[model samples]
Structures are given as structure tokens and as C-alpha cells.
Target chain A: MPYELYYWDGIQGRGEFVRLALEEAGADYIDVCRGPASEGQGIYAMMAVMKSKSEAHIPLAPPFLKDDDLIISHVANILMYLGPKLDLTPEDQGARHVVHGLQLTITDLVAEVHDTHHPIATSKYYEEQKEEAKARAAEFIDNRMPKFLGYFERVLRQNPKGPAHIFGDRLTYVDLSLFQVFEGLRYAFPRATAHLPTQYPHLAALHDAVAKRPNIARYLQSERRIPFNEDGIFRHYPELDKNAA
Target chain B: MPYELYYWDGIQGRGEFVRLALEEAGADYIDVCRGPASEGQGIYAMMAVMKSKSEAHIPLAPPFLKDDDLIISHVANILMYLGPKLDLTPEDQGARHVVHGLQLTITDLVAEVHDTHHPIATSKYYEEQKEEAKARAAEFIDNRMPKFLGYFERVLRQNPKGPAHIFGDRLTYVDLSLFQVFEGLRYAFPRATAHLPTQYPHLAALHDAVAKRPNIARYLQSERRIPFNEDGIFRHYPELDKNAA
Candidate 1:
């Protein structure tokens, strides 16, 4: 049976991270929520799994992967589980832990990115919290972004195996997620990220490299790859994109 | 040699999660930064590891564990690594993933708790972002907290084995972390969390059970468990805790 991935239908959101991994690996998987409701797949079908009291391991949220009897949740946790199975992680156990650490850092960075727009509340619309969002976005662009990106850049530059990937020489899920982060940041903060090629050359290069990968390259052009939208974590709003060099 | 756990010296912060697990398991682990500088363990010692070019697995932030040569980062990642070693995780691989998923959800909630006091920027003081903090805290108290806690409550209530623990019949690292979260939330939002016992009885009982554990009870009274303060993630700011029954 094909692996079943459950997530909100409209936007890529967190599921895209898992999607990227699955797509790059050419893994046979069904995007359950994106499928037809008549075929017993969609948002309601996903909700049923969460609400199923019969199942002892029901997930609290979507973007969970259902492989046979196992249900895996959280992007980093899912990636860690999938990494070994997909042959995307290093062979050594210690090195695999290092890759997981990198993915967790990316998770932290992604949360901060989401807060740039929804600073006050996820329940409130962006317009309702526009002033606070501007303040948060300013801080994110000026300080947090550089701190996180610089850390990753340093990690890449310092890698003994060379700077081609975040861990080891070959591509891993961390590299794919980093690529998505770069794409999202560039889309959300075009003016702020205009210095990427100059400021973070290594990350820029890695982003370029992932985009050129045979599987990832084809996946980007496919309809399966969701486009950046205001509803997603990284949303573009002119007022929040202030302070460009 | 004792396992070396590195984190900022002063506050409980994230390190307390690892500390609770160690204390509960009666494991020999050094709280590296908490020791005196002359003993070759302090904030400087932690910085040395992070800044070391020789170390390939340098952690981006602390609350990291140094298990001999392996340096593991992030609270959830560290716990996931230590859970099995400490015999705090279930024997089943699938069950361990469920525990990890729960831990990751707690990680999400903890991040939200931090934002209640520092809504704008981590670089800025609470006084600088007091207004934004208030707005964020109100949302947290009114919406986010209950949503997260409610989900956990449901999970506990719906568990097949029993509601005595989060997963299976044994107390995992997840339960230890949950105990810390409850303690932190009550300290930070006394009035807001006043309904925890009645609203989330299972969680309340789990908290009580964890505290009653002989090792944990001793650790609570000992200097090892730092008292929650303004410097930590869960800060008690009256202005931020405005709306409470």
C-alpha cells in the first residue's frame, strides 16, 4: 500500500516539507486530503483519523503520515523517521542525530517565520494585527533571520565533508527543507532577502543546487508543488517587508 | 564519565527538561554550565563547544547533551535521544514515535509560552514590548492554551491502557516534560491556570503523580532544579496575565 499523507488541502503549509522529501525520493504516497472526498479522502477523512478514539495513536493535528499501522506527526519527527527509510540520511547513527538537530533548528526558524505575520494570534486576521505584525516582522528581518541563517551558513562552511550540503557531501532532507526556507523567505521578504547571493553565499548555493536536482527540478514545475500564497506561513505583505539595503 | 549537559547557567530555561529526566532516572549527568568556571564547567565552557571548529556537531543553542563524543541539540531532539537510554521510552518503536509526537506538541506550546512575554523580539526587553506582550498573552490565555491543553487532555483521556500515563503504562520523558510545562505554566499564569485541575484533571493527576515520584520529589527540593524566574521562558508578568478568572 502507498503511504498516506494527511494535511490541509488548500496550502502547502508544514506538509510541504514531508511532500518535498517524498517527492525527491520518488516515494509512492497518496496526498489524502488533496484527493477526492468521494474516494474516502479529504479534510474530513483526515479529521476522522484524529477523532478516532478506537485508534490508540491518533494524532493531534494534520501533516501526519500514515504508513500501514504507524502514524507519524511533526515535520522534523516525520523527516527523522522517513530519512533512514528513504536513504536520505547518513549511514552512521551519530551523524543521523546531527542531521535531526539541523532539522529541529529549521523547525524553530520556521515557527519564527510564521510569527512574523501572525504575531498576536492565529485566530486573528493579519489586518487585525497589522501594527504588531510590522513590529515583529521588523525584528525578524533585522535580527532573528540573520542569527538563524548565519548559523546555518557557518554550519555549511564548517562542514569537513565540504559545503555542498548541510550534513555530509550528499543531499539530505535538511538541504531540501533549507531550500524551501530560502524559497519562502525570498517570496515573503524579497527586499530583505535581496542580499542572499552576497550575505549568505553558501545557503544561496545550496538552494540553487537543490533546485537543479532531477527530482526536485521536476517537482517544482508540477501542479503538486503548491505556489506561495498569503494563507501560508511565509506571506508577502509590503508593510512587513521594510528595511532593505 | 558522567554525560555532560550544556545550557545557560542562570535560569531553568530548556535545560530543566533534560535535568528532570536525568534526576528521575537517577542518571549520572553533569549540568556543565551550572558548575564553577575553575572546575572547567561554566557558561564559557558551553561557548567553547559551540565555537569549536574541531567539533563537527556543534549545537546552535543549548539545552544540548554531550554523550561522550556525540553532541545532541534542541530540547525534543535531546529528550528523544535520552528517552530510550534512560529506559523512559516504551519498548515498541511505534509507541516511542507517539511519545515523541506528544513531546513535539509540548515543544510548540512552550515556544508559545515564551512569546507571551517577548512578542516583538528576543533582543528587546519585556518593558519594550509590554503592550504587544499583553495582546499576545491574552490570546494565549483565551485561545491557544486551552486548544493545546485540551488536545493533550483528550489524548490522555482516550489512551487505551489507561489515563494514568501519556503512553502505555510507564512514565516516559514526555510525562517528565509535561510536568515541567505544568509547573512553568502555573508559575507564569497562576490565575489563568487556576482551572487546570478541573479542566484537565488527567494532566493535573499526572502532574501530581510525577511530583510524588521519590527522585523527582528530592530533585524539586534540591538546588539542581532552578526556581522559575523572569529570565526563563515562563516569566510571571502581571501585566501580561490580565484576563483570568
Candidate 2:
């Protein structure tokens, strides 16, 4: 059975989380809206399919996954579906709930990141709100970054299993996502993240461990992975970067 | 088994969605955080029970659910966990995916609502971001509103069950959530929703049908149902309201 992954090729955005899962799982899948199609290829063709409505069920956005019989949307929800399928979620319901609670916290963090730039509006240009972004970025840098990262660091530190994996000892999708958040934060806020890992050794180790995972390492090296850029969610605006002092 | 809900007093905010699900299902529960301390107790005590450490798996935020041995957070994730338990989700994986898809869309909508006033920064006053918010709010009202509500209207139209419910003939968690979004939007963007409801009959019908459901109806009449207020996500600012004229 073939799985079709749909997302805009213009930016990594939210789609990459799902992509990371698929890559790590080594699933048989195609980045439908992405990849080569010669003349009518890449993201354009994928967009055509999404807007076409010929496909059985339409996903609300690109990050949706189409398995043989199921079309799943929502980043965390998609991970929920793929988790048990790929041994990423714990078998027990209680554990899964804890994992989900943590993922939702990550969702909150991601929203904050988006806000650091857009602040008041998603429809306008970031430049239009550049002044607003500066203030929002300051509050985010001062309050939110610490609040969110601190919560995760606490979760890691308080984990019963010696502060290793977020939920279970084995790597879960939540762990992988935390790694992504750290990577994106570092890319976007190197000055901030440099000071961050020191506060949470376990989180840093987990981020490093996930990056070293064989499949992720391969995927990162491969051309399939899209590089982070200004257009993407974690864009680095040197102005938003905190001072090292 | 007792179920406890923790959130601030007054205004449904995010907690309303959870309240709707619990009410619709006629579940045995308590809205502890909002209830009178003499009878229901404050959030601190609610926190005490939640963080008892007997389970040691307490949620990081309010609006979490504690049912017997399981606890969950995130509005949508909580619904996902509760959907099956309350028999609000479909039996098949495909249907469940669709339901989860809608829930996540609601999450996006919620975030957008928060952005309307806090377009520049959530940590600062709306007054500070008023200018940027005016621009963002205009785009949100003009573009995102129609896009989101229109897509949902299409979902209802395409539901294959006479467009009475969001999913099918029966009431699903998503249906209740859709109604909540309608109520929130109406409260937050009264003029905008009014101008647009005629354009999406299916969604309008959904808002009506869910309102009349027995349990939901009772809950609305009860004082337990908080009115929309400035403290919540969907704030009503006259400037942001679309003039019916």
C-alpha cells in the first residue's frame, strides 16, 4: 500500500513534523505535492490535486497523511494515528494521554513562535508588522521561551525514568518533536538556545540523540529534506535573536 | 468514577468546548475551578487532586480531564480521548480521522481568535497593538473567516446526511465544537458572522441544531454556562466588529 503525503513545497512549515515521522518509520510514501514531475511537477501538481477534489477525501491542509484507507490531518493528531502504527506511542491509554498532553504543550510553543513574527495577523506581511514583531519578540524571548522550554525541561527532569525520554524510555513522536523544536529554536535563536541547553542537559541529550538516529541522519543528509529559510516557520531574523549577555 | 475540570471562573474560554462535550454526553463531572468554593472548591484544591502524585501524571494546564485512571489535555486531544469514551466518535478509523481533523481545525480557529487583539504580542496590552490589530483583524474578518467557515460549510454540505450535522445524522464531538465556534465567532465578530451565515446555510443549521440538543440546552440555561467576556480568547472589540451597514 502506498501513502500519499500532501503539503506546500514552498516552506517546511508544519508539514515537516509529519514528514519526520514518515522518514523515521521508513514508510512507503510519496511527498505528493512535492517531488519531481518533469513539467507539471513538484508543489504545483500537488496543489492541483488538493484543490482538485477528485481525491476521495480532501485534507484541510498539506500536513495531512493519506494511508491506504485513512486520510489523517492535524500535526499532533496525525502523529497519534501514526504513533501506534510505527511504535512511537505507548500501548497504555494513560501513557498515551500524558504523551498527548506534552505534544499539545509543543503545539502551544509552535503557536508562540508564529506569533513572535506575525503578532497580530497571519494575513499581513511580517514587514508590515515589523515594529509589532519587535515588541512581541521581546516578550516572547523574555517570558514565553522560558515558560515553554522550562515546562519541557521540568517534564524531562521529573520523568521517572531518569530524565531520558519524554514519555517512555524508547523514543516517541513527542521526543522527536521536542528535538525539532530545539533545532528550530537554535536555528532561529542560536544565542538563546546556546544558553538554553546548559539549563536542561537531558533535553539537549534527547535532541542530540534523535538527530543521530540513523534514519533521521540519512533524511537530514538526503536532498529530500528542505533547508530552513526565512520563508519557513523558524526563520532567523538577527534582530529577534537575544543578546548573549 | 468522578471527573473534574479545572479552569478560571467566568467565561467559557477554552473550557466551554470541554464543557459542551461533557454535557452532551451526560457525563458525571464537576467544573471545579469555576464553581463556588463553598460547594465546588477553587483551582488550587483542584490542582491538589490532579497533582496528587498518586497518578503523578497531572496535566500542565487547566481544561484537562481526569477519568478513573486516565488524564488528558489539549482541547482537541482531550476531545479525541473523550470522543470514544463518550461514544461521540465513529467506530471506524477513517471516520475517527475525519472527526479529529475537524477538531484540529477548531484549534487553528482558536489561535486566530487570540491573534485578533494580540496580533503584536500576547504579553502586552491590546492597546499597544491596536494599530497592527486593526490590519490583522481586517484580514481575519475578510479572508480567514470566510475561508474557515466556508470550508466547514462545504464539509456539512458534503456530509451526505442532508447537512444537518457536521459529520453525519448523529451528533459528534466535532458538531458540538462547530456550534461552539459559531457562538464564539458570533460573540467575537457578531456583525461578521451575521453577514456570512446566510452564505453558509449548512453551518447555520448546525449551529441551530446543536443548540437545541437536550443536554446542551440545559447547560446553556444553567449558570454553569459562562458568558463570553474580555478575559477569553474570543474578545469583543467594537473596532474589530464588522458593521452590518
TM-score of chain A of each: 0.98, 0.91
Ten-residue stretch with the least lDDT total in model 2 chain A? A49-58
For each candidate, the alpha-carbon lDDT, in order, equals: 0.90, 0.80
Assess the local accuracy of residue B152 in candidate 1 as a C-alpha lDDT between 0 and 100.
Answer: 81
iRMS, all models: 1.3, 2.7
Evaluate every candidate with DockQ and list the scores: 0.74, 0.54
- Local lDDT at A37 for model 2: 78
lDDT value for candidate 1? 0.90
Q: Candidate 2 on A1-245: residue-level lDDT in tens? A: 76777777867788888888888989888887677777445777666755754343455666777776567777888888888888888998778867977887887888789878877567778898787788777778777888778777777776677577888578889988988899898898887678777877888989999999999999999988898888888989988888533
lDDT of 1 at A221: 96
Off by over 4 Å in 2: A38-41, A53-57, B36-40, B47-57
